[model samples]
Target: MTAHFVDLLDDLRRRSLRMAQLVEEVVREACEAVFQADVEKAKRVVQRDNDVDAEEVEVESEVIRLLALYQPVGSDLRLLCTVLKVNNDLERIADCAVNVAERARHVDARTLAGPYEDLRQMGPIVVHMLHNAVKAYGSQVVDDAQRVLLEEDAVDALYGQIIRRLVAEASASPAKIAAFLDVLSVAKNLERIADHATNIAEDVVFVCTGEIVRHRMH
Candidate 1:
C-alpha cells in the first residue's frame, strides 16, 4: 500500500473509533438515566443523538471518499464497507438510547414495581458487545467479531425473560400499568440496540473474512 493509502485508512479507523465511543457513551448514560430517574440526564441523551447522527454522516462520507480516491481492494475495501455498515448500526443504537431516554422522561408518578435488574443486566452485555465489535474491527480480528455474534443469544434470552416478567406484572397491577408498559418499551429498545450491535459484529466478520454469516448461523 502507498503511504497515501495507509494514511487514509488510518483516518477512517480513527473516525470510526470516535463514533463508536460516542455511541457507547450515549447508550450507557441513557441506561443510567432511566435507572436513576434523572430527567435531566435523559434529556441530554436525547439531545446528543443529533451529534451521533452527524458522526454517522461524517463516517459514511469518509468511507465513500476513500473508496473513490484510493479504490481500496481486498482487506482495505472490506474494512471500508464494514465501516459504512457499522456506522449506520452505531447511529441506530444511539437512536434507541434516545428512545429509552424519552420513555424515562415522561414516566408517571407511580413507582415501577421493583428495580429494573434485567434491563440493567442487558445494558453491560450490549455495551461490551459494542466495545468488542469495534475493537475487533479496529484490529481486524475475525475471531473477536465471531465472539460478539455468539453473545447475541444471551441478550435475546434476557430480552425474552424481561418481556414475560413485564407482561405478568403489568397484567397484575392495574394501577401501575402505564409505568410497567413504559419500562417494557425501554427494555425493547435496549434489546434492539443489542440487535444493531450484532449487525455491526456481523459486518466486521464479513469485513475480515469476506463471509456474510448473517443467515448461516441461526
Candidate 2:
C-alpha cells in the first residue's frame, strides 16, 4: 500500500477513537444520572446516542471504502476489521447507556440504595470494564484485553445477586415493586454493557494476536 493509504488508516483509527471517547462519556454520565438523580444528564445521554449512531455509520462507510479501494492485507487488514467491530460494540454500549439513563429519569439511585447495594456497585464496575475494553482497543494489547475478560465474572456475579435480592425483597415491600423493576432494568442493561465490553476486548485480542478467541476458555 502507499503512504497515502497509511495516512488514511491513521485518520480513520483516530476518528474511531474519538467516537469511543464520546461513548465512554455518555456511559459515565448515565451512571451519574442514576446516582445523582440528574434528569438533565439523562437527557444528554439520550441526545448523544444519536451522535454515536451517526458516527457508527460513518466509520463503517470509511472501512468499506478502504477495503474496496486499498484492499489492505496482513496487519492493516486486521486493524481495519477490528476498528469496524469495535465501532459496532461501542454503539451498542451507548444504546445500553441510554437505556440506563432513561431509567434514571424515573427512579433515582437513592430510592433503591438501601437494599440493592449490588445494583449501585454494578454501574462503576461495568463502566470500568468498558473503559478497559476501549483502552485495549486503542492500545491493541492482549494483556489489557485479557484483563477485561477477567472482569465479566464479577459483573455476572453482581447481576445474579441483584436479581436474587430483588426477587426476595420485592414481595416483602410490595409498594416498592416499581422501584425494584427499575433497579432490575438498570442492572440488566449494565450486565448487557459488560457483555458488549467483553466483545470489544475479544476483538482487540484478535487484532493483536490474530487469534479468534471469542468462545475459547478465557
Candidate 3:
C-alpha cells in the first residue's frame, strides 16, 4: 500500500475507535438512566443515537471507498474489513443502548433490587468487555481481544440467571409485571451488547492472526 493509503487507513481506524468510545459512553449512560430511573439521562442517550448512526454511515462509506480505490491486499485488506465489521457492531450496540435507555421510565430499581443485582453486575462487565474490544482493535493485539472474549461467558451466564430468576419470581409478584418486563428488556439489551462486543473481539483476532474464531472454541 502507498504511504497515503496507509495514512488514510490509520485515520479510518482512529475514526472507528472514536465511534466505539461514543458507543461505550452511551451504553454506560443507558445503564445509569435505567438503574437510577432518570428520564433525562435516557433522553440524552436517545439523542446521541443519531450521532452514532451518522458516524457509522460515514465510516462504512470510507471503507468502501478505500476498497474500491486502493484495493488493499493482505493485512491492509484485513484491517479494512475489521474496521467495517467493527463499525457495524458498534452501531448495533448503540441501538441496543437506546433500547435499554428507553426502558428507564418503567423501571423502579429500588423496588426491583432483588432481581436487578445480576443485571447490574452484567452491565458493567459488558461495558468493560466492550472497552477491551475497542482497545484491542486500536492496539491490534490478540491478548487484548482475548480479554474481551473471556468476559462474554460471564455476561452470558448472568443473562441466563436473570431470565430464570425473573421467570420464577415474576409469577409471585404479579403487580410489578411492568417493572419486571422493563428489567428483562434491559437484561436482553445488555446481553446483546456483550455479543456485539464479542464479535468485535473476534474480528480483532482475525485481523491480527488471519484466523476466524467465531463459531469454534476460543
Which digits, one per residue and each the tens of the lDDT, describe model 2 over residues 1-218?
Answer: 49999999999999998999899899999999887888999999999999999999999999999999999999999999999998988999999999999987789657758777778889899989989988888888899999999999999999999999888989789998988889888999999999999999999898888999999878
Which candidate leads the pack in TM-score? 3
Q: Against the true structure, what is each candidate's TM-score?
A: 0.90, 0.96, 0.96
Enumerate residue pairs that collide in model 2.
none
- Tens-place lDDT per residue, model 1, 140-180, is 77788888888989999988988888778778888888777
Put down candidate 3 lDDT per residue, 53-157, tens digits, no spaces. 999999999999999999899999999999999999999999999999998877776854764688888878988888898889889899999988888889989
lDDT, residue 184, candidate 3: 85
How big is the positional error of residue 38 in model 3, measured in Å on the Cα after superposition? 1.3
Q: Rate the local accuracy (lDDT) of all candidates.
A: 0.82, 0.91, 0.91
The reply for model 3, stretches above 4 Å from the true place, is none
Candidate 3 versus the native: TM-score? 0.96
Checking candidate 1 for backbone clashes, the offending pairs are none
What RMSD, rounded to one decimal, does every model reach? 2.2, 1.2, 1.2
